[model samples]
Structure formats: C-alpha cells, structure tokens
Target: MSLLSEVERDEERRAGARGDGDVDQPANAQELAAMSKLISGSGLLDVREGELEVQQRNPNSPLHSVKAFEQLNLSPKLIRGIYQMGFMRPSRIQEKALPALVADPPINMIAQSQSGTGKTAAFLLTMLSRVDPNENYCQCLCLAPTFELAKQIGEVCKRMAAYMPEVKIGYATREEKYTRDSYSNHHILIATPGTAQDWVMRYRIINMAKLRVFVLDEADVLIDQQAFRDISVRLSRHLSPGCQILLFSATFEEPVVEFARTVVPEAATIRLKRQELTLDNLLQVFARPASIDIKYQYVTLTFGLFGLAQCMVFCQSRREAEVLQKRLQSDGHDSLVLHGQMEISDRASIIRRYRNSEVRILITTNVLARGIDIAQVNVVINWELPVMRDRSPDFETYLHRIGRAGRFGKKGIGLSFVVDDTDERNLRQIEKHFCTQIHEMNMDDPVQLNELQKKVRK
Candidate 1:
C-alpha cells in the first residue's frame, strides 16, 4: 500500500536491509546517494566517526497518545484554542508528537506523516506554548519551502493562537517589511528559507540565538534542493543550541532522511506506515489520447461536464500550464495558472482567489503538489504525469499531486493523462506500488461519465 513505484519499493527494501535510506544520488540515483554518504563524507553533514546513527523507534512504547487534547495537560486557554479551531482529539501525528514536542526538556522531533493530518497545528501549539508572549523578540520561527506554504502556516498559527491575543505571528516572506536597525516584539516568525536566512544572517533584524523553537516545514524539499539544503545548514548553524527543532514532511526520500538526522539528530521520530498514504480517497483513472494535443480534448470534456466543481490540472512545464490556462480561458472557463515562474505577489494573489473559490480550474506545475489547502478542490487532473528529474515515474510527487483533491478523507477524482507508452508504463508502476486499480476512462461512454459525475457529487 506504499505510494512508491514498484522499482522504488524494491530499492527501498534493499536499502532498508542495509539500513541506508535517503534520496537522490546516482541515476538509479537512489543507490548512489546512500552509498556515497556512507563513503564520501560529502554534503552538509561532516561524516561522524561512527557510521550514521540510526534511532529505531520502540515498537510498543507509547509516547502518550491521548483521546482528547485535555489529556496532554495543556493550558486551559490552549485547549480552548484547539477546540476553537475545531480540533477535538489528537490526530495520529498530533497525539504522538504533542507530548514529546511540548515536554519540559523540549525534545527535537522528526515527523513523517501524510498531508492534511494536522502536523501544522501540532507544531504551532508547541511553538505558541514555548514562546513567552509577554517578552517577544521572535521566540518561535518556522521555515517553509514556498511563500504559499509559509502563509499557510501563519494562518493556522494565528487561528490556534486567536484566544491568546498577546501571541503575534509575523511573516518573513518576500516584500515583508520588518523593523530594520531595531529588535522587534513579534513572538512567532513564519518564513521561507531564503527570506528567513536573510532576516537572520543578513539583515540582523531577528536574532536566531533568541529563537526557542525552530521548524522546517516540507523539510524533504528543503533537504532535496541544493540551494535550500545549503541555506538550511547555514540556518541550523545559527539556531540557539537549546532551540527545539521540528521537521515535518509527507515524503522523505532516503538521502533527505539522512540529512534530516544530520540537522536534527537524536530526535523523537513519528512516521505513518506506507499503506496510510495510499490513494484510498481518490478514484484513480487514466485517459490515453491519440496524440499530445488531444489532452486538451480530455481537459475541455472534463470541465464541460463537471463545470461547477473546483479542480487542479497539473502540467510538467510552466509553458504547458500557461498554454492550458489560456486555452481554457478562451473557451470561456474561469481558470488560473500557478507555476514557479510567476512573480511572488501574483502567485499569492492567484492562490487567494483559488482558495476563495473565485476560480474553478487551476493549471500548474508541481509547485502546488503539496502545501496549499483548499477543501473545495475535489478533482485533480495530471495533464502531465509526475516524473523525477531523471524522468522516472515520481512516486512521491504522484502521491502529493492526487492528494490535493482527495483532501483529509473526502472522496475525489484523480485523472491522469498518458500520451504514450512511457506514461502508461509509469502509471502501471504506480498502480503496482500502491496496490490499487486505476481504471481506464472511456470518455465517449455517456453512462460512465455520468457515474463519474455522481461520484464527484458524493
């Protein structure tokens, strides 16, 4: 029930047998990274004297899973805030993570859980509880990979701290004007890596030494990208020695896991089993077009039939996304485009509209594969199936792409487009790995399309 492709699962089993799981190295790339780390002493981590330390979780020991938020001995005010935010009990990750995160000693945590599982809230509570709102100078700091995600974290933190008027959350994203040449009173700082790095190392506005809790949201992406990985390492060097470090992501390839250990070592760890991340809530299907251009036919037909439902159509390139959006718009569809090339402000504006349901279709690249949360998104179309940089089927990205639609236990439709045998092969591998069936869609069949409409309406 894992989300990995068949080939990656085989690699995982072999790597696990050897106890080395990290991401992207050699062309088979999987094996190269792990093998190199065990040998070369390269990358951010200076090879320790002993081989990389492995902290195995105790199978039976409970770190304290609570039936309710009150069981955690949280301040009554905090419990009220949780309930105010509509959280009644602890989610899987929250239950195991809250007690460890808010403990007196403040344990470091490395958590790998499915998306939409309340990881953001769990950490925000720990951060808010740790910060002294009365004497604020950016006591708690969280870094996400994108401005959209950083904003998302800020929104959740604000809601959870709504009752605690003294707790303030500030952003360090692009164009954020923080006090210069002066120390500020903001208690919580949410930002992306580059801006956060500049704020800490370059501008000297917020002192890293004063931070009590440091969080890296979507840590796998931070660790996977070289520029982000470098900034993360530099940021880690600036964190107060006592700062509680928390890293959370849905997918952690092996090398990224190794780097996570290097950055936040000897930490409490919580991970959902592989089966938990499968596409149980998404109705998976694929449509093969006679040619690449025919993908537009599928797109128009889908929107033409299900015009009211919000959907996200993922493309492999910015150009394709732009082209699709233009085509859809010309055809009288209210669609928007979100890709990496757009200006930050434009990107933020588009997401705001999409979240507010001002638009029905969002065509984009992998940028929206993970972070943004819009409950209205009930359909996901893989206009271009996700693939790794090396063009192999991207098991993790595929999981995240479809995950955008079937959010948090809601049923949704995930349709993938295959223009050639290569895509068909990749889709089959995805099916084999996740142990699920993706029925071939027959667009010409009126009855089948009607059934799809009914499923979506459900």
Candidate 2:
C-alpha cells in the first residue's frame, strides 16, 4: 500500500486547517488546565497514598511512613525548595521512603517504585539532606544506567536545591570532561557507572570513601548487565563503612532483588511500590501489522484519533524512529524524533518541549521509557515490540514504554504492533508475564474506533 493511497495528500488543508497555537491540545484541554492548577497547588493529585507493604530488617526500630514532608525534619532550605518546585507534599514513594531515607545515622535501603512515582525526587532530596554543603568533597553519589538519565537526575536535584546555593552537584557522564579541581569539590555526583568507576578507580578523582549516600537508580537494569553489575560491586566496596546506599528501580525481578540485598546488606528495604504488574488506568491493545506503508497508515490514524493529548511512539532503532517521523510529517503530522544517539542537549530540549505541549507526537527509542514523566502524554505506541539482545521478549522495556502514558495515574491508551509471528510470540509473552490481557484492536472497525474515542473523552 502506498503511504498516500488511502488518504488525500492535501486533505488536511482542504478540511479545517489548524491555526497557529491550535495544533497541540490534550484530549480535554479544560481538564488539563484544571489538573495543572491542582498540581501546582497540591502536587500531583493522582499519586495519592496507595498500597505499600513495608518491612524492617531490624525489629528494634520499626520504621513508619511519614505523610507530610515536614515529618522527615528536612533542612529549611530543602523544604523551601521542595515547595517552590510545586511539590506541596510527599508522593506515594516519598511518604514511604522519606522517614527511612532521612532518618538518623543514615539508613541503607532498597526501594522499588514504578515510573513517575517521584523516586528520583525522593532520592535527590535524601542526597541533599545528607550532604553538608559547607564542606563538600562529593559526600553523596547517584549512578544511573545511562548518561541521559544521569543528566535528568542532576536537573531535578538542581531544582530541589535551588534555595541552597552552597550545594553543588557534578556529572561524570561519558561526554563530560572534569578535572580533579572541578569535580572533587561538589557536594553530590551523578554519573553513569562506567564513568564513575573510572573516575574513582583509574583517576582517583572521586573519593568514594567520603560518600555519605550512594544511590543506584534503575537498579534492575544495572544488575542485569554483567559489566555494570561488576563495576557497581567494586564501587560498593569502596564506599565508607557507614555510608548509606539506596537502590531504586521500577521493577525488580526476584533474582535482582536478591542481588540488591547483597549490595546493600541488611538494608531497610522499602518496596514502596511493586513492579505494578498491570497498569489499571492504561488501556492496552495490540494491532496486526501489514506492509510498512500500512503500518504508517495505522499510526497516522492513531494520532488523529487519540493523540491530541500527545503520544510517544517507541521504535526498535534510531533509523526506525527517523523513518516513522518522516512518514508522519509527510502525512501532515508535526512531530519530533528523540533517540539516545542524539546529543544530550537536544534530547533534553525535546523532552522539555514535549512536556510543555510544544510537540504533539514524539517518535523515539527506549530512551524516554524509564522514569521520565510528562503529564500530558496519554498515548504510547510500540511501533515495534521491544526484544532483548538474545531475541527474547523484554517485558521490563514493554512496561516502561507503555508507562509513558497514563502518567501520574491519569487515563491512557497503549497500542502495540504485531508485525510477524515473532512479534506475536513476544506480545503473548508480555501478556502472560504481566497477567494482563491486551485487546486485539482493529482500527478498521468503525464501532471500535467510536468506543476508543469515547474512552478518550471519558
């Protein structure tokens, strides 16, 4: 099928043209406005207290969740920055982990929470609370699986520590160049495992022995990679005996959890959130794919129907994203493409614009999948199902991809394309793994399309 065979090339112009500043809009614009106002006033309302099972390794000190940010007794500057950043109260993860995170004598903890639950903010606050801004030689360290994630964490911490000017945070990303004099004096360090390991082991610029709190974000992914796990273990050994360690991930398979226990031994584990085996607020569906052109057609149709609230289409490769963005734009859909290969500055700019609703659709790989929150995004499409390097289904990636939608517990739609028998098998594996049935949706059916429209409106 030709890309333009099903629809006229200039039909959008012939119909009603979108005026300037009218191209981007949510499913319900008024509703989004109200939600934004509420968020600015009371934090994200959707992430209210939910189910969390707590366990204390030590029976003598029973840790309880704190409902208010003040209960943790954070620094005045930190509290002022938190409120100014529009976080009026603690998130579900914050409420559960703050007490243990900001506790006296610093606690070693393993916390698991799904994407968008404020895990980054929770841990950043802990890092800030632990650091002594006056006399700093990298007192706190946070390592992410990727440099982009490391940069994202740095930005969040900067916002949280805006009122505390004396606090300094440094990055040791692959692209970053830092000297001993420049990097050694920061209060906190955020970097990728390989780079941080190099700085600590080879260059000896980062004195890990001085670290007070060491955080491993995206712990499951880190442990799954042999190279990263090895470096992480070596780094753990270098930390001060009394240094606190925090490991956080969206989903933790049992084996990974066990490995985490070894790293943060006797850790006060805060399973504040389970893997979220299922996203109750997200509508899941799968579509059968045909020719390449036909797949593009279905994607364009999807954007027209439910994508005004914005959409993220995940591609398996960078070229795939470029191809899809080209096809989508040719069909009169203005969109953006983001991939890990792009410069970090470009990636950050795209994410910020997407969050501000400047871009309606973003085509990319798994870079935005983990722990990046954009409230207006309500639709996520797996242009191709994610698979591991060994050709097996990557269930964790699938969960994170779809999680981009229904963010902050809002309603969302997630669709996956099954291109061949292999994709079909992968989809089946994902469904079985999550224990959630994905509807086989036929966009060709008029009644089904109407129902989807109604769901979006609802």
Which candidate leads in lDDT? Answer: 2
RMSD each, Å: 13.1, 10.2
| Pairs that clash in candidate 2 | none
The digit string of per-residue lDDT tens for model 2 on 94-146 reads 88788888888788888866545677788999899988878858898898877
TM-score of each: 0.54, 0.58
What do the candidate models score in CA lDDT, each in turn? 0.73, 0.76
For model 1, name the residue pairs that clash: 21-254, 22-254, 22-255, 23-254, 23-255, 26-29
Worst 10 residues of 2 by lDDT: 21-30
Prediction 2 global C-alpha lDDT: 0.76
Candidate number of the best TM-score: 2
Q: Indicate the residue-level lDDT of 86 in model 2.
A: 81
Q: Output the worst ten-in-a-row residue range by lDDT, candidate 1.
A: 40-49
In each prediction, how many residue pairs overlap at the backbone (N, C-alpha, C within less than 3 A)? Answer: 6, 0
